[model samples]
Target: MHSPGAIQPAELWRLFMRAMAVVDYARPLELLHVPAADIPAGHAWIRVLACGVCFSDVKIARGQMPFSSSLRLPHIPGHEICGEVLEAPGGFWFQKGDRVLVYNYWGCGRCPMCRIGQENLCLNLQGWVGFTNPGGFQEGLAVPPERLLPLPPGISPEQAAPIGCAIATAYRAVVTRAAVRPGELVGVIGVGGIGLHAVQIARAAGARVIAVDIDPRKLELARVFGAVAVLPEEAEETARRWGDGIGLDAVIETVGHVHTVDLAIRMIRRGGRLIGVGYRLGDMASIHTPRWVLEEITLMGSRYALRHEVEQAIRLVAEGLVRPVIDEVLPLESANEALERLERGQAIGRLVLQVGSFSGV
Candidate 1:
């Protein structure tokens, strides 16, 4: 957050009590200040708790994946976060000190898609926190009140921050997209951040879990998270065997690698589902889909989570049914290092950014 260039704390703080911005290509991820901003009748200004450094953030920083051209420059990149209320605008269930998880995606409130409970696909999506607009990587996040999901008890702020994206995205992959069933066999590809959570959520739903990853360390951790079987990266036979020779009932692909997708598709049974949720780091590679189509294996793509899914994720964590593997919880000052490690695929699990918890961690 240190400014080596035209440092102007006075000017920035005048508009916001404190400002947080991560330079995408040519500026520093900065921290500044400003007088409070106006909260519309259905909105609130929230004090941030913690933010999960997403792979998308790294892509945005490296300019590997481009943002919308319409988006203004000097954009912030955090999209997974949990926080508390700084000020309320009334006419909502929220109150001061209410622990909440921010569903980063906000859409046109009254749109047909939103009315049907598909805000993630709203045509006029207003964008996410810290990406297309202001986000929770700062001391506070000002957003429409509707985007907030009140956190359940027994979940600390820092523990809940990564839940909105990582955990909820996994939930959607299993519960909604994959539609796993009790006593069914489910394969989760890439046992890193998202795959780790996906394994647990699938296991929680009464499925026998098989986790795949290139790293043995991640595979072992997946076992610890209730995975019944841990398969190596190239183990297509492992999946087929686990699927009882017919192929698996469901496979959640969190890795975008083409070879991995091919292996996962080969492991699905007739009428099985495959849920994919990863980005093209650089070159966009395609996976072969003839086997999937021939076998009637369903394929579903999941992105960000909606408010209720995030709420459900919080409850799961608070109840001890699921817990995030915080490989390293460092302060916001060390964000660049965290992002670098994440980009290298060296992180075992979610790398949480302790924004205001500097003194503790």
Candidate 2:
């Protein structure tokens, strides 16, 4: 294999699957052939191995996500990418055949947030791959070298792919943002991809975990992921069962619905924290302002993982402290089915698309 730093041809064609339109509900993504020369500058060429299908992708494909208007059509909709470095610009450190995972956040590096190592919250944001920019639903990826994280040994590309977003986002919410500590009771709402990982990360942080979801299968999987208590979506009933009608220490809400937000707030104890990681468009929830002030509850929103947080999340997976839960592995052509599963909330942990075969680390 040629090294990523080795320069060769300027024009190469690659086969890729991409969402051709947002209006078509029957089929949103399809395969296409595009020239390598069309890839944006300052990006390394990577052979995409696997990409995880996130609920955000489903929303984007359906034209339901916030800022969905910014997406250019014929777009590829996958952000959690695992790939092998095929080529890199001069001075780039990655080499050919090196396994790596793409960090979904791409930011203007000169901003204060980027300077502080929080590129995911960049003030002058460029756009997230798979959302605003070209993503890894295709056979290859053009990624900024700085956005690539090395794939740890013993973790296959398929396993590490979901870590790019699902695990990384959960770790940031539970470990970095929430700062969950030992003996604290942490509640995870909606045990889907990110929520399931949140339960594991909270448990690994030594916090007692309580997970709530409408699906019984997901709740059962949450128990397997180390959640001490699992409950249905009835927040009132859940609150009654835990802490003797008091509340929880922290609640991570992954399903961004009006009622879920209300439920999260209702189940929090005084001086507790609620971190929101989900986004629902055109939906509003009301909170009792007086109660919020009196109870001293902190409501915060967490986006994707920071660069350092993504690295930390990867290390946790490498050490076996956390594992990526994959509900199904499908081919690139099965992207529609994967998205449909996510839209229906049928996937337990994550649905990954194996875009291309990898030789392993």
Candidate 3:
């Protein structure tokens, strides 16, 4: 077990850890000292190595998401976490110094959804890391042993960080919810961080993917990831032409705007599926009920991935099937700058924050 030099374990909880906090909505995160909390009986104290900056973090920071109102002030926001175990209780699968990727969701274990391995859909969620509780934007975190997933071989902490959210969420949308079939025509709207990953995942599933975005750069990146890129105006025409004049077999909408949802619904053929993987508070989409009934179109909402899906996503990365595209890496102190870049639509892929050094592992 790793110790804090000459200091003892009893003194660890008394020390302060450096962290970035959101003191107010629509404001920059401020650097502050956070008191370390005592580790519970079944929990472990982790030293954070890296955290991915998600657009959801941007929304939460700007108070644009529905959960923003419930968020406590001075909360640390970072869900995609990769870290090392500094201290863990006995009789657990992992020990101290082990590299781990956090699953983020802490569901009520007794709930019906959680009983069936669907913890992401738990009826009574206990806490979600970086959302309902303190997150990995700090030097250290207290996490339950069950929420920690083993970081497989051949992946760095920085690369593995986003697997907790972006890649896994895309995996759930494309593989689990949509069940994309080989030789199918798939349309992915809003080729941003998650959308780009969705494009790659669908292609890896043997489907022909068409990526739609307003930005030329994102579309170009999607093309590089093995998708036929198209603009918003050209999406419907391209989908019809590509799907042999019917429409796309499935549409994965990652932008929750009403306009994007409408576009996604319009791109689907008869009996096609529309998977909604993103959303904004108070935004609603209107569907034409007559056409919907006649076409038998299906609309589904995909939350985050299940635990096994996250493991599969890790395996995909470890085996070199899909690669997480990261735009830049910055020090933890540059979090505000990274969020600004994301807010301005300047990030092509994901931006990560390196919180601590990862060496000899």
TM-score for each of the candidates? 0.88, 0.91, 0.95
**RMSD vs true structure, all candidates:** 4.9, 3.4, 2.4
Worst 10 residues of 2 by lDDT: 11-20
For candidate 1, give the lDDT of residue 35.
Answer: 48
The parts of candidate 3 lying over 4 Å away from their true place are: 1-14, 359-361
For model 3, residues 1-361, the per-residue Cα lDDT tens digits are 2336745764453267778888999579999888777677788888899999999888877888777888889999999999988777788988777899998999999999989888888999988888868888888888888889998778998899999999999999999999999999999999888999999999999999999999999999998889999999999999999989999999999989999999999899999999999898889898999878889999999998887899999998998888988999899999999999998999987999999875333
Please report how far candidate 3 places residue 351 from its true position, in Å. Answer: 0.4
- Number of the top TM-score candidate: 3
Candidate 2, residue 114: Cα displacement in angstroms equals 2.9
lDDT of 1 by residue, 1-361 (tens): 2232433553243244444455556545665553445555667766666888878777666666666445676566687777777567778888777767787888887899888989998888776677777665566667777788887677777678778888889988888888888999998888888889888888889999888877888988988888855555445677678777787888998888777777777777888887888757563545347755666767778877777787788778878888887788877667778778987889988898876532111
Quick one: how many clashes does candidate 2 have?
A: 2
- In candidate 3, clashing pairs total 0
Q: Better model by TM-score, 1 or 3?
A: 3
Selected candidate, larger lDDT, 1 vs 2: 2
Give the poorly placed runs of model 2, Cα more than 4 Å off: 1-27, 38-42, 233-235
Would you give me the overall lDDT of model 1?
A: 0.75
* Angstrom error at residue 106, model 2: 1.0
TM-score of 1: 0.88
TM-score of predicted model 3? 0.95
How would you order the candidates by TM-score, starting with the best?
A: 3, 2, 1
